[model samples]
Structures are given as C-alpha cells and as structure tokens.
Target: MFSFLDKFSSPVKAMLILTFFGIIGSALVAVSYTVTKAQIAANERAVLTHHLAVLVPDNLHDNDLLSDSLQVTDAQALGIAEPVTVYRARYQGLPVAIILNVVAPDGYSGKIYLLVAIAYDGTLLGVRVVSHQETPGLGDGIEERHSNWILSFAGKSLINPLENDWKVKRDGGVFDQFSGATITPRAVVKAVHHALQYYWEQRERLFL
Candidate 1:
C-alpha cells in the first residue's frame, strides 16, 4: 500500500505541476500577443501607407483614410476571394481616393492579392500587390522590383479599359506582357477589369 501510494502520488503531482506550467505559459503567450497587437498592426499599416503614397504619387495631406474602413459586401457582391477591406481617404473633408482590396484567383500559381486606389472620377491612382502566389521570376514582375508593368494601370479610367487595351504587347495591348508569363498578366488584367467594373457598377454605393 505504501509503495503504491508513493509511486502514484509522485506521478499525479508531476502531472499537476506540468499542467500548471502549461496554463501559465499559454496565458503569457496570449497576454503578449494581445499587448503587441495594436502596435504590430499600426506598424504594418504605416508600411502599407508608405506604399500607397508611392502608388498614388500625391502629397498626403493627412492619413485620415486609414481610419475610414468600409464593408465589402455592402457595396458589391464580392467574389469569395475578394479583398478583405476597403478604405476611403479624404482630403480636407472631400473624398480624394479609395484604397480597396482586390484578389485575382486565376493567377498561374494561385491567387494574387492587391490594394488598388482610384480617384473619384474613376482614374486609377495606384496598384500594389498585397499578396500573391505567382511564379517567382516571371509573374513577379507584377511586383515593383521586376518592372513597372502594373503601373501602366495607373491613370487609366474604367471608361477606357479598352479590353482592347488589356493585353501584353505580344497580344497587342498597350502593356507589355512577360516572356513565358502569359497567364499571370492575363489574370491581372482580368482582375483590374473586374475592379473597374465594380467601381463603375457600384459608383453610387461607393461614393454615397
């Protein structure tokens, strides 16, 4: 009886001790994550805002647009993979630009996430890929480092997408398509066209 008590008691105590430590460790991790959450998100936003400035190329009078979050479904019947958020920026109380999420799921490798900004008059201010699963060398030109290919969309309006204007040079569009990189550019062009169509169809919901 004494031997049994000794053996079982130690195992039970050890388990209790381990359980306590596990609980404490989990709590600490949760607390740390909670405390740093806001700061980390703010830092991320700052980086994106800087990128937006590069895309938009206008003096930021203020950063108020970052604060104005809008619902995606309220304005349009977004595709399942649509960007998660849209923000409307204002200059001196007037709507200057809109920053919205766009996703091109037809990317050769997978979906490509984008942040697109357009002026009230439907002019594209800037476009930045927020996330993508495109091939490394070829499709990556959609990124800023490879080339300014995506930048071609800037200044274009929905009124003039010129689906005729939506191809790589090989395909005879005003833009240059990558060598051995047709699908990626095609997906991007289609996504941009969709975004424009969304803006055109839902202009009232967006502006109001």
Candidate 2:
C-alpha cells in the first residue's frame, strides 16, 4: 500500500514515485553486478587458461598453472617496470615450464605484451604476443595469428642461439624481421632474449 500517496501533492507524489524507482533501479543494478561477477571472472579465467595453454601445452603440465604463479620484476632483464606474474607449470611435482608475462617497451607503436614459456632447463617452449599496437600488416606480424614468426622462438635457448645471435636477421642474428617493419620485431626479439636471460639468472628461485 501505496495508498498513502493520495495525501501527497501531485509533485510530491511524482517525486516519491521517481525516488522509489531510483531505489529499485539501484538495487537491480547491484543484483545484476553481483550475479555476473562470478561468471565474468570465470570467463576471464577461461581465456587465460587458453592463452597459457598456447605457450605451455596442457599435456605438458599436470599441475594447476593458474594457481602456481610467481611475481617477478626485472626492468633490465624482463623489460617490465613493475612486478609481473610468472605462471609455473609442473608435471608429477617436477618443474615443467614457466609462462612469463613480459613487456617489450620499444615496439614500433608502443609496448608489446608477450607470453613467453620457458622449460625448466632454459629451453624455450613457445612465445605468444598477448597484446600490441604495432602497425597493421607489418609490425603486427609478431603475432602468431598474423604470421608464424613468433613460433621461431620455440625450442630456443640462450645457448642454442649462442647469446650473440638473439637479434633479428637484419641485425646479423637468426630471427627474421617483418618486411618493411624491423623495429617491432626487433623489440620483441630483444624482449624475448631478455626474458630468457632473466630465466637463466633466476631459474632456481623461479621454481621455488
């Protein structure tokens, strides 16, 4: 009973109606947010799992990669200014590989985020471009969807490339640079190389 509204002036009644609707709307919004939050989180987790799987295959790791993560920060080596998450994968309680969220700050357009998976013994399992703003059709070739260039990092290591051959082919290394777009690939190559070096320096601590 809203019969009490009969005693109020028309304007007051209108105001009261609006206020009631406002409260209801607010409540509905809160309920919707509460209801969708978990689903949104689950969707995000699913997407992350897919990305992680791309670098560290599901068959290679038995442990929960999402739960087994470490925070690492090495501006010079990892090219990140702040702490970044490193997802660790294990099989039968033994280290399988680590997926690092690395940043290449010198991309042609801006910074490039990468998912680099390195095995326990410093071998690279895979590398994926998570995000980047490189020029379309050129620098964007660093993306696996754009080109298979990123896949070249698989199975590589600091020693496999001899440390001196980590740059793009244009720079006298083995990696290839995109046609007419060298800066983007160069940045990614450097970032991946640094990520490997960081892994080499912190391999023991990374597993623990």
Candidate 3:
C-alpha cells in the first residue's frame, strides 16, 4: 500500500486513502442499520405492547392492541403537530378501549408523551407517562414507577372531574401536584383531558 502511494503526490495519496476509508465507513454503517432494523422494530413493538397491557390490561380486551391501530391528528385537542397512532382494544368484536399516544406540549421541561386508555363509553381505563423530561424527584411523579399519581386517572371520566376541575390542586382542580412540582402534573392532566375530548369527538370514526 505504501509503495503504491509513493508513486503519487502526497496530497493525492492522502485523498485516495481518505476516500477509500469513507466508503468503507459508509458501507459499514448501512450494513449495521439494515441488520438492526428488524430488531429495533420488534423491540419497539414489545415496549408498546407492554405499555398497552398496563393501560388496557390482558383481561380487558381479547383483540391484539398492536395490530388494531389507527392514526389520529388533532393539534388542538390531542396537542399533536403530526398524526399519532391510536391503538384500539376490542373484546369479542366489541370496542373495549382506545389508547391514544398523546403529547403534552406544555410539560415543564418539554413535551410529555402519554398513553391514554379510554373505555368505549368515554370512561378512562388508565393513563401512563410513556416518556418525559420533568425534574427527577419532583415532576417525575407523573410516572407510575416514580409515584402512583398516574393511577389516579384510571376509572375517571370527563364528567367525573367536571370540565372545570381538570387541573392540578394548585390550579383549583381535584388532582394533586408534587411538593415542588405543579407544571408536569398540570400538563398531563390537560393532555389526558384533551385525549378524552378527542375520543368523544371521534368515537364513531375510531371504532370503524
């Protein structure tokens, strides 16, 4: 390799070596991505299935939540700038619940992702924080692992809390906030409420 390079100018030799390595690097990257693509997708599906099970549960629905999904787009109600996936759970051909992948754009640090499960008749089956960047000990309470606060949304409906009382206690609502954190819970509450409203507006279309 050095003997061949010595025949050419130093700059040209270096350029050829750099170009050769670049192509090799690019090929390796492409191969790696192709090899891992399927595994990545499978892992994502597994995580999503786990989240859905936590919200809808195994006994609640007989249908496959992963397969029965629809895309929904509602910037205002769902707070989604782009269309998001909604997983539908059914039992014996009847709608059991619909899980919306909602984004709370007003989270304290940034947008908070949520999986909101609403029963066929607008009752909230459960709500889970899929991901968020809220503060560690405070705002992170919205997570089920961090605190049971997320479970409070289960069995609740828009009418149960009343439209006016959908905010955190600091905001004069029924829900409680962390000792030093309020924005995280408030944003989640607002997002879940919007998800319920979105389901109400699209209930008929969703099941179809």
Pick the TM-score winner.
3
TM-score-superior candidate, 1 or 3: 3
**Candidate ranking (lDDT, best to worst):** 3, 2, 1
lDDT of 3 by residue, 96-125 (tens): 889999999999999999899999999999
Q: Assess every candidate by TM-score.
A: 0.78, 0.83, 0.90
Q: How many collisions per candidate?
A: 1, 0, 0
Q: What's the ranking of the predictions by TM-score, best on top?
A: 3, 2, 1
lDDT per residue, candidate 1, 1-208, as tens digits?
Answer: 3454465678786787787789999999999998899888888888787877776555643545556767675223233443367777666767777776787777899978788887778888878887787889999989987788888888887566576776656777766788899888887777777777787677667745
Error of 2 at 51 (Å): 2.9
Candidate 3's clash total is 0
What local lDDT does model 2 show for residue 82? Answer: 98
Q: How many residue pairs of model 2 clash at the backbone? A: 0
lDDT of 2 by residue, 1-208 (tens): 3798999999999999999999999999999998899898888678778889888888998998989998988888888789999999999999989899999999999999988999998999998887889888888898778889998999999998997899989999998888899999999999999999899889889999
C-alpha lDDT of candidate 3 relative to the true structure: 0.91
Report lDDT per candidate.
Answer: 0.74, 0.90, 0.91
Could you give me the TM-score of model 3 versus the true structure? 0.90
Which of 1 and 2 is ahead in lDDT? 2
Deviation from native of the Cα of residue 167 in model 3, angstroms:
1.4
Cα RMSD of all models vs. native, in order, equals 4.3, 2.6, 2.0
